[model samples]
Target: MDTKFDLEKISQNIVYVKPVVTADLPTEVQDQVGDLDQIYAVHNASGEQLALVADRKLAFHLAREHKMEPVTLH
Candidate 1:
């Protein structure tokens, strides 16, 4: 038996974790991350930010918890 799959569907579960500057974030977000210079952001395949975590580990962990395959972006 053979099956065909769409590339877009295959990559739907992939997400990326990238470091973001706290200062560059919105005023409300900056206020939430007080005293921290950087944070991590989890983004989906379409580049929409899903969540903002305090550290890289948490970012990846959160993605996995939601059944997403997380990759690091530098």
Candidate 2:
């Protein structure tokens, strides 16, 4: 008998999923960003297009700054 997989159960195994554009993105990045543009795209070493990255470094920096932490990568 064919059994259907439970979405909630399946979700627990997922580490990451495809990203999409959202209203939460910064205005500057949002202005330049496109409906189809992914803030971050996962790819193989060869650089093939894969998943979308909705988050950006600047946004992370802003968050870190708010917490008074160094956002710079060393």
Candidate 3:
């Protein structure tokens, strides 16, 4: 899939905001949002959405495939 967002820049900006594959998600999150397909947005403490992702796994896979290291939280 084609994406406008630059995955490399995104990874450098905030790894936590980075997307992850379904297999990468924690058990709790997986249970809550079963089969996560995409990440709409990520908000900061200021309540401002920083980034918008179309496909979660796709994005993560792209990043990994491209050798881009995204930040990971928890």
lDDT of 3 at 14: 41
How do all the candidates rank in terms of lDDT, highest first? 1, 3, 2
Give lDDT tens digits, candidate 1, residues 1-74.
Answer: 67877878759999999999998999999999989999999999889999999999999899999998899988
TM-score of model 2 (CA atoms): 0.24
Runs of candidate 2 exceeding 4 Å displacement: 1-18, 22-36, 40-55, 68-74
Instruction: Summarize candidate 2's per-residue lDDT along 1-74 as a digit string, tens digits.
Output: 89887976543333322244445556776776667345653333233433334565543444344442222221
10 residues in a row with least lDDT, candidate 2: 65-74
Alpha-carbon runs more than 4 Å astray in model 1: 1-7
lDDT of each: 0.92, 0.44, 0.50
lDDT of 2: 0.44
Clashing residue pairs in candidate 1 (N, C-alpha, C atoms within 3 angstroms):
none
The residue pairs found clashing in candidate 3 are 15-71
The predicted structure with the larger TM-score, 1 or 2, is 1
Q: Specify the highest-lDDT model's number.
A: 1
Clashes of 3: 1
Candidate numbers, best TM-score first, in rank order = 1, 3, 2
Considering lDDT, which of the candidate structures 2 and 3 is the better prediction for this target? 3
lDDT of 3 by residue, 1-74 (tens): 87699766654544334444545556775576655664433434334545445555554555456455444433
